[model samples]
Target chain A: MNYIEHTGKYFAMLKQIFRKPQKWIIFKESLFREMEDIGINSIGITAFISFFVGGVVVIQMALNLENPFIPRYLIGYATRMSLVLEFSPTLMSIILAGKVGSYITSSIGTMRVTEQIDALEVMGVNSLNYLVLPKIIASVVFYPLLVTLGIFLGIYGGMVAGVLTDLISMPDYITGLRTDLDPFHFTYSMIKTVVFAFVIATIPAYHGYYVHGGSLEVGRAGTKAVVWTSVVIIVLNYFLTQMLLS
Target chain B: MIEVKNIYKGFNGVEILKDVSAVFENGKTSLIIGQSGSGKTVFLKCLLGLFETEKGIISFDGRNYAELGIKVRRKLREEIGMVFQGSALYDSLTVEQNVMFPIKMFKNSSQKEMLIRVNEVLERVNLEKSNKKYPSELSGGMKKRVAIARAIVMNPKYLFCDEPNSGLDPQTSTLIDNLIHEITVENNITTIINSHDMNSVMEIGDKIILLKDGYKVWDGTKDEVFYTDNEAVTSFVYSSNLFKKVREVYTGNIKL
Candidate 1:
């Protein structure tokens, strides 16, 4: 489909998901299941990557500031900026775009192919609301929490790297985390994750919900959902950064 | 009764249903039957309101679907129970949960009351013991039974089944067919089944509409199927050599 048509349908799907659920109990159950699937399960990977990547960023910073005149604390400062400003939110969200986004797409897409969605419609259930809303709500609630975790872990990772390398003293690393910390950077990160969370939830759902054909198409939808979600996240990240930070 | 008048449906201007009309009488198992690509599934989807027709007015008990407000439409839809080709059970839910799903959605019954009704339906379909098992664990026949149990759990006024016996063995297919017919008669529901399964057609098709490439070529009962000279109907109904020979014997054109 063309961009205009895709955009129109995406908005149409967005509208479909906001209605009151036919069964509040069912919706509540589904929502909790999604939180477990998208959030709780995601904790391990996000934490692991955030820590290791954060340490690697600090090491890279140390290597780059090879000049003897440069202050040791700059490693901590640069790691702080990277962790809070970009790495935690953007990189982790891209990872989620792969992990959570594909799950939403493949599951919904399989339902479409299997006539499970049709069963919902025939029974007067709003398939989109029943299927997509929980994931959207879950991602919205959880992405920020994950991003917060990512931020704390990233800085801690940086601190670990700094102290172990003996390039910066432990006190200096702690001082670096405290020094000139603008609360707005976190505000900026939260806002970006919220937008990307919306992106991650809805875009994959759109791909999956409209998918035609069989199992092959469902797999295709998963790949397409990831690609589109990541693209939207990157693009939205730039805009949110420009609009919020600038 | 469900009446669809001059239904016209198409996808992207290419017609799949061409001004077809039919009545599905209450307390009877009416069927839409045709070869593949003859739009049987599309016709069923149109009847189920899963697909919107470009031109048609389908009514249930004199109430027009198009004219019903959202709340009313939903009310009508809630009265509909569908057995999809794949049975369409939520893989995540156990048999009992699947059966309980619709009653939980439409009624305000307590869990005990709902479980009683769920057990009743599961017992009717002979699936009471499979309550805790998930859809993944059931055989094709068991899954279809579970699908049937789920469909009728709400005691819907209308029931739609798309290819209820498509993948079952002959014995299981007959069992599914008999169960559907029995439920339809017992509940007095306006049941419409879409099938290319000839065994189902011969056994339980109370009213049958034959579609040929989007057009309703014939509408009649199974007995009429034996006598009709309409080549489309005869060719389709007696496509098998055994059935053709039986038809010849019935018409006295061949010796016993």
Candidate 2:
């Protein structure tokens, strides 16, 4: 489909997601299952990426500040800004768009291909509500916590870099973290994360749930899910930064 | 009973089911038999409400499906149990959980009651001890049995089986056919089976519709197959040499 048609269908799918579930208790069961699948299974990767990326940002900043007049404490300040303003929210969400995003698409796409959705439809089980709502709720609930963890690990990794490499001291890093803490920056980051969480859940679901054909289409759906989610995340990151941080 | 009148279904302006009408009565197996592209699946999907037809009146138990609201449609949905061609049991759930799924979704029964119902259907399908096993752990025939058990666990009044014997050996195919037939009779479900399996048709088809190129060309029982001169029905049923020999013997055209 063209861009307009795709956007229209995406909104249409979201509209159906809000329809009443076939049963709340059964939906509750799916919610917990998907919570574990999206949140618990994802923390390790989120943490690993957050820590390493934080260290890299510190190193990059130190290398760029060749001027002798610049203070070493600025490295920590920049790291804090980068983590809270960008890396922890935006980068972590992009990573999730690849990791959790592909998973949701592939699993749902496989179900669609195998006639499992058809089975649910015949049973009068509102397949969209049964499939997508739980994943959306799980991601919305837990992804911000993941981003919060990302923020913590990011700063901690920067501190480790500072202490080990002598670019800045732990005291200086701690001071920078506390010096210019704008509460709105954290709120803005969360607002972005919440939006990202919804994108991560629903975009992939749209690709997967509407997929036609067999296993090949399912695989294509997964690939397309990752691509579309990454694009949407990046585009939304830009717009959200403009709207909120400006 | 279900009555379909002048049903028309299409995709991208290409008609797949054209003016098809038939009556599927309770306590009998109604078979929709056609070639791969003859739109039997489309017709079945229309009956199941999975596909919306451009024009048709499908009356299930004297209520028009298209006229009903979502609430009433859902109420009717609880009475439908479908056995998919791929035996589409949830891969994540165990056999028992798969069987219990519909019961849990449609009824407000407690755990004890649901488990009892699950086990009862499993036993009816002769799959008592396989509850803990997953779909991947079951053989093809065993998977079909489990699908049947899952379909019937809710005691649905209308049962739909789509190509139930597609991937089974001949003996196992007969077993699946007989199991569905016996359950349909015992429970008095309005069973509609879409199959290419002529063996299933001859063995259990109480009423059958033959379709070709998006139109219903013939409708009758197994006994009528032996006497009918309709080329579409005969060519489809006697497409095999074995069936040809059996037909010749039955009609006294050749000595055995």
Candidate 3:
């Protein structure tokens, strides 16, 4: 479909949603499923990625700052800055794009290929409202929660690295982290995560909902949805950071 | 009644439906019979508004389909119940949930009322005890029954079935056809069915429309079909061995 037609259908779906919002029950069910799938199941990967990323950052910082003149406690400040501004949102989005994006694509694409969407249409139900809206709502709502979890794990990983490497004393690490951190930085990271979550959820669900052909086509669509949404997440991350930081 | 007039539809310059038109009456089983690529399915989709016809007007009960607003279209759609070619039951939902879906969507029935309606429809389809089974666990015939039960759960005025017996055994196919016919008569629904099955054609074809290359080549009653001199239809109909045996029996050529 062309962009104009697609956009028109999207707005039509939105309009249909307002007419009968009683279907919010579907959204609630979807949110529950998405939270479990995207958030709870993702904890392991998030923790692993955060741990390794923190370790890598500390190693890189130690190698570069071998000059005895520079205080090693600033490593905590550097770690804090990267975690709050860049790593948390970016890494969380990448994980979500792989996990939640693929899930939405597969679920909706399966529904589409199997004619469940058509069945809904035949029943005087707006398929987009029933299928896509719940997913969009879930992503817009739960993505921030997932991002918060990501940030918490990432920070904890950094703390683990600080203690293991002894780059700074434990007290100095804690003090440096507290002194350099700004609440606004956390807020900015959260805002970015929210936007990324929306993109991850909406793009994949859109691709899946509009998928045609059989299971093979749905599988192809799911792959495409993940790849394209991840690319969009990365590109949007750059632009959002530039704007927000500026 | 549904009127499809001069409908033409094409995909990628390949015509799927070419100047097709037919009238499906209320309280009758109107079967569209043709080969796979002969556009019977496409024509059905056109009637259902699933695919847009490039040049045609489809009117349901004297209202132009294209001119109806979304709300009106939805209201019109509520009058339609479709049994898809594949049954199209939701795998994740139980049979009871699937049957309840339409009622929950379009009606103001309470929980108790909806359950009563679901059970009633399930019983009507002879599936009262199988409400808890998922689509995956049911047989092909059973799934088709569930599809029928779901389709009619809303008490729709128009019912459409696409290839109602495509994958069923002969016995099951006949049963399904009879069930659909009986339901149409009982509910006074204008039922349009797409099928190439000669068995279905002879069984429930109160109004039969034969399509060849997307054109309505023949439209008449079932008895008229057997006697009609349309060479194309005769060749198509008599290609079945069962019809040939019936022809033999009629001609008194059977040897004891």
Candidate 4:
């Protein structure tokens, strides 16, 4: 489809998802389940990736700032900036775009091919509202929480990595973390996280909800969902950064 | 009664259903028998309002579906139930939960009331003991039974089944067919089944509509199927030697 067609369909799908659910109680129930699926279930991988990347960034900073005139605390400062300003919000989202995106696409695509969605529609249920709305709401609410947790873990990991490696003393790292800490940078990252979260939820859902074939097609849709979600997140990250931080 | 009048449906200008019409009666098992690409599914979907007909009217109980307001259309949908070919049971929900879904969505029943109704339907489908099992754990026949139970949980006025016995053995297929027929009669539902299964056609086909190449070639009862001379119906109904033999026995051409 061309850009206009795809955009129109996407917005149409968005409009459909906003329709009142068949049952509010059922919608609430699904919302909690999705929150668990998209948020709670994702903590382990997010924490692991965030901690390691945080440590790696600190190590890289230590190596690059080998000049005798440069202070050792700059390693901590650089690590803080990277994790809060970019890594926690953007990189973590790209990862989630892969993990959550595939799950949404395959699950909904499977439902489409298996005729479950048709069953819903035949029963007077708005299938899009019943299926996709919960996920979108869950992601929009919980993704920022996950990113916040990621930011904390990543900075702690940086502190641990720098102090253990003896490249920087604990007091010096703490001082660097406290010095010149702009609260706006944290807010800027949170804004990026919210936008990326919306993209991660909706784009994959769009792919999965409209997928028209069997298992092979569902698989292909999943791959396309992940790729598209990541690309959209990156592009949006650029625009959001420009608009919010520039 | 569900009355379809000259419905025309197509995709991208290529017609899949052309000027097809039929009346599916209440309290009877109506089967739409056709070959692959005979527009049986398309016709069924159109009847279910999953696909829109470009031209024609589908009226339920004398009310034109297309002309109904949005609220009325949805109310009409709530009165309808469907059993898909694949069973289409939610993979994540247990059998009991699956059966309870419609009730929970449409009715303001308490959990206890919902469970009671769910167990009642599960028992009706002979699946009372499998409440906690997931769809993945059920056999093909069991899955179809669960689908049936879920479909009838709402006690809907109209029931539509798309290839309900598609992947089951002969005995299981017979069981599913009998169960659907029994339910239709018990609830006085206007049941429409799309099938190419001759066993199903002979066993429970109270009224049969035969379609070929997007047209309704012939329609009649099971007894009439043995007597009809319509080539499209004959060629399809007697395609297999076993069915041909059965037809002969019915016609007394050869004694059993």
Candidate 5:
């Protein structure tokens, strides 16, 4: 399609989406499914990886401070900065691109190739509103929640390592976290996460909604949605942080 | 009733319909028949406003389709129902939900009323016990029936069927033809079907328009078609082996 044709379709989809936002039961269902599948269910894997990541960070810090020139409690400052600035938003987005992005792409692509979308058009139902809006809404609503949980668990992981490894006293670690953590960094992370969520949700939905061919094409679209969205999320995360914090 | 006047449509600089003008009357099954690539489907889509015609006017129920606003176009769509070449039922929805789709979109009926209407239409199409089944589970014929049930559930004033019997067995095709014809007559709907099937043409052809190379070559009733001297019509009518065998039988050239 040419630019004009593509723009026309885009506007038509937007108009349809806004026409009847209330009649979005299917979107709500898909959103709930995305949250459960992407956010809630992936918590275990996120926790495990974050625990090891924290352990690695603390061990490296302890070894570097072996000369006793640097304060041992500064490990908490380093952990807090890394988790708030990069790890939470970036890793959570990667996980969600795999989990929720794949689901949205596959489901919408199947609907497109199966003539279900055409059926909606013939019935005067807007396929975009029925298919894409829910995913967009779900991503915007749940991605921040996931990022928040990731940050908390990530910090807790570092605390467990610091206390169990006896590298730093428990009181020292607690006081370090309280003093080093900046509320502004947490806010910035959340803002970046929301932007990443928009990119992750919209890109996959766009690719899937326009998909043609049969099952093979749907599979290709699902893979493409995940790969492209993850790349965009990482690239955009850098720019968003620089723009917001610099 | 629907009227198409001097409509010209083309894709990629190749004309599919050139100056095509025809009238589809109410309470009759109007068929547009032609060989493959004869632009019957394109013309039907043009009539339905799915494609914009390059030139000319299409009026549905006396409203100029080209001049109507989006709201009016949507209102017109509400009174129109289409059964696509494929059954086009939503795979995720049950049979009952498929039939209830249009009603939900354009009607203000209560759940009780909607269910009653859905069951009535399903029973009308002889698909009573299959309400909860998905489209994947239904046979081809059953799926078509469900599509028909969905099309008519809203009591649309206009019905369009594109090759309604295309992929069915001969017996099932006849059954579908008879059902479409019966429904058209009973409801007084303006139905326009696009097909090249001679069986369907002869079975329910209240008004048949034959197209050849983007031009309407013949327009008449089924019985009237037998007496035409047009060579294209004669060749098409006699091309079937059954008609050829019947011709031989009448001429005493075969021992029947």
Candidate 6:
């Protein structure tokens, strides 16, 4: 349909998804399964990407600020600021929008095509609430922890890279990290992470839940879910930064 | 008994079911047979309350379906069990877990009690030793049996099957048909099966409703099916050369 129709349908779906679950025990079990799927399964990729990106950021800063007047400690300070303010929250979520987003879409889409979702509905279960809400809860609850790990590993990687390259000493880098630590920046990063996590979980679910046709359509929905999630995250990143940091 | 009264269903302003009406009785296997695109699925979905009709009434055991509130509708759903055409077993869950799912959702029975019920239904479906196997590990007929076990695990009052014999070999198809018929008789469930399988139609169809191009052209018992001169029914039932011969032999038109 058109953009307005899609927007209306999305809000309508959210309304359905937020209902009280039929059975709390089942909901709890699904929630735990989702947490493992969305959070724990993502550790390796998050760590690998964050660590390498952190090192690359430090190297770029060191090379760009190579001048007699500019302080060497600025390299560490810039790495810390960039990662805490934008990289860990926004960039990490964009990656998850691709990784986790496609997974949710394809899985839910598969269920839709195969009539598993219909079976749930036939069984008097709220299919949307049972399938999507758990993912939303899991991502919102554990994404912050995942992003926190991103921030820590990212900063550590920067420290390691800077010390190994002799571009900046460990003590100077440590001092730069502590130079102007504002608790709110971390809070801002967290707020952004939470928002993006919701987007990552829900957009994909929306795509999957509404998927029609068969396997070919499911694949198309997965692609569309990832693309729309990334787009929404980027747009929301700008707006959130404006609201929270300004 | 499920009473459908002049129900009409449409999608995107295109009429799919055109004022179709029929009564399905309890403890009997009623089959809705139609060609592809004849709206049999829509009719079945309408009966299952998966699709809301634009007009007319469907009452289950004297209670109007459309008039029921959301909570009441859901409560009604707990009494309804559906076996989808694809046998939509949850791929991630093993056969035991899949069969136990509806019970786990709706009943507060103890784990031991639940296992007993699950095993009882599984054994009834002749799937005694296949609890740990996943859907992917099972053959087509086995998967359909698992789906049946899951559908009946809650001891539902109504059981609906959509094309249950679609993709099985003739022996397996007959086996599935007999299993469904036996279950209906044993549980006294108002079983409604949507199928184009003439074999299944002849075997277990206590009542057969024929839909052609969104209309109920003819409906009767298996014996009446042979005697009726309804063009739509004959065209559909005796469509193939093999069925034409079976009809001839059954009617004593020529020596076997």
Isolated chain A: TM-score per model? 0.98, 0.97, 0.88, 0.98, 0.86, 0.99
Tens-digit lDDT string for candidate 4 (A1-246): 887898899999999999988788999999999999999999999999999898888888988899989988778788888899999999999999999999999999999999999999998898999999999999989988999899889988888888898878898787778879999999998889988988999999999999998999999999999998999888988888889888
Question: Model-by-model lDDT, in order?
Answer: 0.91, 0.91, 0.82, 0.93, 0.82, 0.94
lDDT winner, 2 or 3: 2
True contacts kept of 4: 0.89
**Residue pairs in candidate 5 whose N, alpha carbon or C atoms collide under 3 angstroms:** none
lDDT of 4 by residue, B121-187 (tens): 9999999899999999999999999999999999999999999999999999999999999999999
User: Least accurate stretch of 10 residues (summed lDDT) in model 2 chain B?
Assistant: B243-252
Chain A TM-score, candidate 1?
A: 0.98
lDDT (Cα, 0-100) at B145 in candidate 2: 96
Off by over 4 Å in 6: none
Expressed as tens digits, the lDDT of each residue in A1-246 for candidate 1 is 799999999999999999998889989999999999999999999999989988888888888988989877777888888899999899999999999999999999998999888888888888899999999999999999999999889888877886798767887677777778899999999988888999999999999999999999999999999999999889888888889988
User: Residue by residue across A1-246, what tens digits does model 2's lDDT show?
Assistant: 798999999999888889888777899999999999999999999899888888888888888986989876788889989999998888899889999999999899989988999998888888888999999999999999999999899888878876798877787778877877799999999999999999999999999999999999988999999999989999999999999877
TM-score of chain B of each: 0.98, 0.98, 0.96, 0.99, 0.95, 0.98
Query: Least lDDT summed over 10 consecutive residues: which range in candidate 6 chain A?
Result: A68-77
lDDT, model 6, position B176: 96
Better of 4 and 5 by DockQ: 4
TM-score (chain B) for candidate 2 is 0.98
Q: Write the per-residue lDDT of candidate 2 for residues B15-37, one digit (tens) a residue.
A: 99999999999999989999999
For candidate 5, give the DockQ.
0.44
- Identify the candidate with maximal lDDT: 6
Task: Order the numbered candidates by lDDT, best leading.
Answer: 6, 4, 2, 1, 3, 5
lDDT per residue (tens digit) for residues A111-210 in model 3: 8887788888877787776666666666667767766666666656767776787655677666757775678898888889888877887778778888
Error of 6 at A104 (Å): 0.4
Which pairs clash inside model 6?
A: none
Better of 1 and 5 by TM-score: 1
Quantify how close model 5 is to the true structure by its C-alpha RMSD in Å: 3.5
- Candidate 1 CAPRI classification by DockQ: high
Which interface RMSD does candidate 6 score?
A: 0.7
